[model samples]
Target: MSGPVSSTPAALTAPPKSPKVAPAPPAPAAPTLRDSNNNNNNNNNNNNNVVIDGILSKLLGARQTADGSCARVQLTNRELLEVTRRAQQVFSEESMLLRVSPPLRVFGDLHGQFRDFLLLLDQTGLPPGTRFLFLGDYVDRGEQSLEVVTLLFALKVRFPTSVFLLRGNHEVQPVNRRYGFFQEVTSRYNLEIYARFGSAFAYMPVAAVVGEKIFCVHGGISPRLHNLDQIRDIPRPARVPKQGLLTDLLWADPHPAAENFTDNLERGGGVPGAFRFRPHMSRPPALYKRPRIFCRSTTTHYLLGA
Candidate 1:
């Protein structure tokens, strides 16, 4: 306590002087993979080195025409058979009604127009990055029926989660035989190939849903399709079913004129199963078409296309 007591080593009693620490500098931004010459070369090499033996890979590597239309003959009979078998096997595993997510590119009635299909692929990106739900008629009435169907089957096999194929009227033997695909396959390959394709079609889904909003069908809706599960519960791997939800989905067309039509009698068209629905339709038609429907308490709905 005497002689100022050396101020009691002032630091010990006074608030301890905080260590003079310099604030940390801002951390550098995480490194990003900017495409560079070195990286591009590596990526190219990796892509080249990958060994794929499936039909999809064959289609990917197959030479397009000068106009980038139809694919040339890339598969042998053996390869085509194997691919068709794979298609039947894979499609069989899918539900009668598919449930795909948003971010899809849906198309209607390719009709064996391999060139247009190729053009579409060129315009829009293919999947798993960009998924697709083709609404049938994959074969018939085009120069490249085999090419189109084979490529589709290959795609479905290659990216099962990313590609979905629905059934159209032309998918059945009765239609395709009279149209073009049946004769085309028979003339080009054989009846065996044609038959195999029919098998694949039998397993195809009649419709698909996108999110909880959209319903995708090739033709139109059925009265029985009032509930979603009705579509889901229809047993698949059977021939285009005779006069039911399945038949209506494949054969019917939209009677857009009528909101809630109940066509009990045919007007001379007399097509036994040909029916229509006031409310019908798909997931994606690209970014071009989006359906905005307004529902009222009266059960009538209005679709405002934007």
Candidate 2:
């Protein structure tokens, strides 16, 4: 038999009260990229100096206004200094041998062709969209070394993972100090700024591998480089040296005409017996030989979106 029904009417029963959970504290907002350079601390203040996005709007605004005329980019001393520090922070976190992925655009030496870089940005997409591996030689030789390096550094700061910058022979102190980059920096600002650039260069990766299928560097393989780990072994925050594997990796060139040498000439310290690589070398270092290797002398190239 069914249980007996309540004697009272249904309206007389009290309703169950719902739990009073204070609406979850509105989900915390995402951290925004404030123009920390500016002292404006108000999170919601509509300050014009604020960097609304990851971009430096003031700087990017000037870039967006760039016409065909190759004009030198303008920046305040404070802005330049800030950029240096920010970029150094980004580069320092990277390894000596960058392990990158594929579908990249490679470039040769761009001796500060800022206008060309801009055009390439127009042709190919910018960072966060396209992955790029620059081979180095970003400074010296080009009239607008400051603009080029600054732009590259800024991009690296904004999109560290998407952008890869390898060290070239010219990135070293001796090469750039004389080949025009030093003079350019000193002319625009002072020796201090030039030295700051040196600090940034010290952290640039010398080599990169993409999808574990390709090897990339500013120059070519060094005799000392028996494996990818060997490249990672070299420490950074130092200038490229005069001898050894690191030197050869940045200095060695392909001899299209093999007739001039017997074997391994100046491969390391101009020593005849020192380790060397030959043009169209049938056998690469055993560890990394399986990957097809290609390199350029600069980060000044256009890259399409992957």
Best candidate according to TM-score: 2
State TM-scores per candidate: 0.69, 0.72
**Model 2 lDDT per residue over 1-306, tens place:** 012233321211212323323311111122223232334335443342222232343323322222434645566676677667767776787788888876666666788876667566544544454567888889988888887787677666655666778877777777788789988998889988888888888888888777775667776555566677877878878566546777766876655454322345644333333233445554345333446545436322112112
Model 2 spans > 4 angstroms off: 1-68, 259-276, 286-289, 298-306
Q: Model 1, 46-146: lDDT tens per residue? A: 34222213444455344444454544654678777777776787788888877777677767777877656755664454555456788888887887788
Worst 10 residues of 1 by lDDT: 24-33
- Cα RMSD of all models vs. native, in order, equals 20.6, 17.8
**lDDT for position 3 in model 2:** 25
